[model samples]
Target chain A: MKKGIFSGLIAVTAIMLIGVIMLTSSANIKNSGSENIAQGIWEIKKEWNNARYLLDKATTDALADSANTGPCTFALDAAKVQHYYMDTIAHIPGCTQAFTVAATAQAGNYQATGTITCSKKISNDFSIKKFEKPAVFTKTVSVQKDMPAAGDCTVIITDAQSGLVEISRVV
Target chain B: MYGENKTGKGFVFSTDAALGIIVVLIAAASMTMLYAPDSSWQKIFQSTSRSMADSAVVGFYMNKVPADMGLETEIPAAVKQGYCGRIYDYNADNGAPGIQSAPMDRNYCGGI
Candidate 1:
């Protein structure tokens, strides 16, 4: 009788151990998914900020000369976009999809807003919850027309979903 | 006396062994779930976000130079012609000379 009872207890313990392993694996999978989402948001923020820089250069060129009729405008060439998009791929570890960015500039008194739409291509499981989200960034710049010196600038990055991460100044 | 106690002690020992195995398994799984690889997703994301923000910071600064220079509207006649692409019709040929390459970054159409 004792021998039979001991064997039964051992079998039950084996089953319980397997169950614990299964539960742990499931949690790990979920964690991986959340990490992907966070990384996606960060990647988009970086691209949008690059677009903002181009807009700033255009603004500076516009104000540099006093006699021009319209603001100085610069078009985003294919090379610029391709260079930035490709460079980021190396930085995002385990990232499979390439990102695309489009910008529409809105110039104000001393500030110019660039509305950027950045998309990432990833597998269904790892893809972000929503594709379209606004990533807003602001830059403060002081421009001097006579001086060809690189002026002081600061950028603020914020997203509707991810919140503020960091403020980087021009290096 | 030995025979009687053998059965009771054996039963208790087997039960204790079963319970201990279950507890250890749970603890092992919990540790694996809670702690494994040390990866900082926040830091990775922050770095990317910083790159984007930095671009805007520089752009804003560079924009002021053009706005201050009054070059916002003052394109050199040669630059304007080059922007037009085709040769400028100096003769009373074309009524309005259309600018070919307009500024894409100039958000405010009205000079900054």
Candidate 2:
């Protein structure tokens, strides 16, 4: 009877140890996965923010350059502005891929609107874990433009205010 | 029979002692794992990252006037105080320009 009890005790102890090990291992794995997900999401968010900043800078630069040449010209070359904006984004690290930007400028006001589409990839040590689907964000800016009432003169564009209007993520 | 009985008694005592030790050890280890520091670190990191995104959005809206306009370029005082991290331009020697690091404690912000 004593021998039987000893054997039973050993068996139970072994089972308990195994259970504990398994539980702790699983918990650690889960914690690590959550950390990775958080890191990935953070990276994506930072990238989006950087992209928006670049777009704003590009737009401002284009406006400034145009103002330097012509003081009261309300007509902005949408294609040229878009080209400069995309070029700025391309120069940013991790944003080497092609991005599309559509821009429109109002005839009278100092407002320009743009839509940006960009892609990002999130990878892990084992594999490419997540691929951010191309997302679209709209940008709108109001520049302080000094237009003449009735004369062919240069437009004074300054004191720009810009921000993202909307952002939609497919995935 | 008497000798066999003595050995059996000894065996039972040793087994009981071993079981007691195992149980104590398992309990201690389980408690330690439950209170591990990694979880806290993970929470801090998550919060810092999220705060960074929030700061970016807020900064964009706040800094409407261009810097050349000589307007106050600083963020709102309420936002700065509310955030646990700082929002400085990412113009480090080797850092990317036009990007801002997320809000985090001083140590975490240093790394960024």
Candidate 3:
């Protein structure tokens, strides 16, 4: 009878050990996946913020001149942001690939949750460069209204052609 | 015959100690994530001042002057009372060239 009780205790200990191993491995995997997604989200937000800053700088500088008007043409100074994006997200130890927007389709307005695929665009070298190769990233983003009351506003991006994006208005 | 085992201790885990340690660790981590005092103040002043100044700059560009004016010039004057007063000279000559002067120079930041 004492021998049987001792065997049961051993079995319980073995089961607990297995549970510990499984839980630890699963937690590690889950953390890694979450960190990757977080990195992608950061990349996208940083890229967009850089774009906005460039636009602001260009417009403010152009404002000093008399020739510029409502919409102006400025080379997308994407190189600076792109280079950083590549080095950080691509070269990192665990990062698989850089985030991307879909090809044949442009990045639509910011949404709370969505996907982004990579696309090809002319690099600063003027030669064809695949941006963040395997240029496809799909991620979720949260965007809120960016306008004041009593006035309607839309973000317009233009160089040769114009792209006007409308944001949500909760009111 | 079944008998009670009086000599055995049921469990050894210290639930209170574990919970207290976990709570302290979480609080420490959260505090580490919080902003430093100077940075926190800068963020507050930056957002408020930038919004005010940006709107003022835009309005000046668009010809939409605010009614409760004179704060722009007053700010520099207030600074003059505490400093070398070089800002007074800077305030005097800071208007945008070729653009029309604001409706009132009374609110100018630099001396006018």
Off by over 4 Å in 1: A1-3, A62-114, A122-171, B1-112
Relative to the true structure, candidate 2 reaches a TM of 0.51
Q: Which 10 successive residues of model 2 chain B have the least lDDT summed?
A: B103-112
DockQ of each: 0.02, 0.09, 0.02
- Every candidate's lDDT: 0.37, 0.45, 0.31
Candidate 3 docking band:
incorrect
* Cα lDDT for residue A65, candidate 2: 39
Selected candidate, larger lDDT, 2 vs 3: 2
By summed lDDT, which 10 consecutive residues of candidate 2 chain A come out lowest? A162-171
lDDT accuracy of residue A37 in candidate 3: 49
Candidate 2 lDDT over A16-47, as tens digits, reads: 87677667777876776676666666655555
Per-residue alpha-carbon lDDT of model 3 for B1-112, expressed as tens digits? 1121454322332334344446655654454344122344544553444345444444443444343332353445544221110010011012232131111121222221
Tens-place lDDT per residue, model 1, A10-108, is: 667767776776676667667766555665555455444443433333233222221121222223333343343333332332332233333335332
B-chain TM-score for every candidate: 0.26, 0.32, 0.35
Kindly provide the TM-score obtained by chain B of candidate 1 when compared with the true chain B: 0.26
**Candidate 1 lDDT tens digits, B31-94:** 6756543255544544443443343334334654333423323334543121100001111111
How many clashing pairs does model 3 include?
13
